[model samples]
Target: MAVASLIPPAPATGEPQSGCYMAATSDCGGRLSREHYISRGLIDGPELRVRGMPWQREEVARFSPDNLVARILCRRHNSAMSPLDAHAIRFFLSVEAGLKHAQRRSLSRKSRFYMTSGDGLELWAMKTLASLYSSGIEFMTPEHRFRDFEPPMERIVAELSSPNPCSIMTLSLPLMQDAHEEQIGRRAVSIGPIVDDETGELSGLLVRMHGIALVFNIDLPDKDALPETEIARPDMIDLIGMDRTSRIFLSRAKRRPEAWIVQIRLSHPRKDPPAGRSDRGCNRQPLRK
Candidate 1:
């Protein structure tokens, strides 16, 4: 379940102030345009009054564009990945905002209850799936964050890197265990017969994109009722990977404020998109840190 907002809060006066562009020069060696830090879509009509503050408060230092280091990316580069960048930026903004406004007590209870479940394996699966949806992953860029790869590129790498041979198997096993413990008051095995230590190591499996780690864990099933294999299976990979879906659900969640995006885009002209394609596409990515 996702919180209402995605973008985080604004920076306090003392926090480090920097632009998203890594190189702020406007030389002819080619220039890069800064993307908006926050998407206008995420902003409420009245929010135009809050200048310079892209996020709410409570956002981590890393997610702030003031602290982000932008790099020069060409037009060809930008167009090829525009959809993902736009979506990611939006997603980042929404998530941060939600965290800042979320009921602190409710969040604490959810964390505590989930933590007590002895099913480390399930926890691992949840973290993996969650990473893909995490705000950090949505706000990433190739030149500045990923360097050689785009945000989704890294997600692909991370998922493929899981040590477990079967992605579905890797995700399902733990989920069954977690659902059992959470829903049914059954105490799962910790070491011997109750738990499968071998599966515990799978928890370490992660899909890291940009600077954030996308992790997942499974929910245990009811002991008397074993897990339903169909739901736990990875049947939605194809749909989730689509450009449109990623942009809507994943990207919008991490968008930065318009001011921030403008600052980053214009910081370096060398990073501008190619001659022909300037604005197009509607895909998105996850953005949170």
Candidate 2:
């Protein structure tokens, strides 16, 4: 199985040369500004960084609030999306609060968590997808030929902004046990394709931060065909908080013989032991059957 790189290279230093990614218009001209690749409100604390496929073997870099930015949107267009940013922040903060509450109580049973937003969450997802796609195009080089691998920006913008947007799924699980030192409270967005056993494919945009994951699937075919798991539906805002049983289920599901697989880490590591141990944050290897 061959895998393609969906992650974009770091931004280069230069004047804004690209058009607005969201509106896809050149009318904005020399007014483009640096836009945060991920919303700032969702991240907390100082050591903000991400690591995984494409980012592997790289030093655990630190990202100031302005680090993960691109000159894609004009000030006017960027300001227009503030409401969506607020919505996404609200959704993420709520999830974080719930996770903290669970940790404090050491809850061992299933509990319900709900968040309400009027299409803001969808818009936020759309904005993220557009930003990532635009950033990839701007930073493309001969060595990295990603033009054919990525989805069309026009098509993505159209579908995401439409009344009936593509399917967006959200799930909450325990903080990944093997999480990198700088990943706590940090947010990262990754894009790729998921190919199932039947050769069916779905373009996936994964946005994860603070123990919550949001997956947006472009042009998903049949929900029935997907593996029977608790994937939060596009219309459902209530989530099943992660617990022991669900954790076990997630661990097993990822190892299933037939599954929908993407080249990304979807499972969290087992909970860590008390601090001060050498292997405290080390990922617990999966048990062999």
Which candidate comes out best when scored by lDDT? Answer: 2
Q: Please provide, for model 1 over 1-289, each residue's C-alpha lDDT reduced to its tens digit, 9 standing for 90 to 100.
A: 2222111122312221122121121111223443332322333333222211224243212233332223333232223224333333343343333322221333231211101111222322332232222223322212222222222323332333233212221222222222222211111111100122555222222222111222332222422233332122121111111111111122122233321110001111222221211222111111210
> Model 2: per-residue lDDT, tens digit, 85-127?
7766766666555445333445455443444462456556666
Model 1, global lDDT: 0.24
Alpha-carbon runs more than 4 Å astray in model 1 = 1-67, 70-72, 97-213, 216-289
Q: Using alpha carbons, what is the TM-score of model 2?
A: 0.56
TM-score, cand. 1 vs. native: 0.23
- Once model 2 is optimally superposed onto the true structure by TM-score, how far is the C-alpha of residue 97 displaced, in angstroms? 0.8
- For model 1, what is the error of residue 182's alpha carbon versus the real structure, in angstroms, after optimal superposition? 19
Q: Candidate 2's error at 140, in angstroms?
A: 12
Model 2 clash count equals 1
TM-score of each: 0.23, 0.56
Instruction: Give lDDT: candidate 1, residue 64.
Output: 31
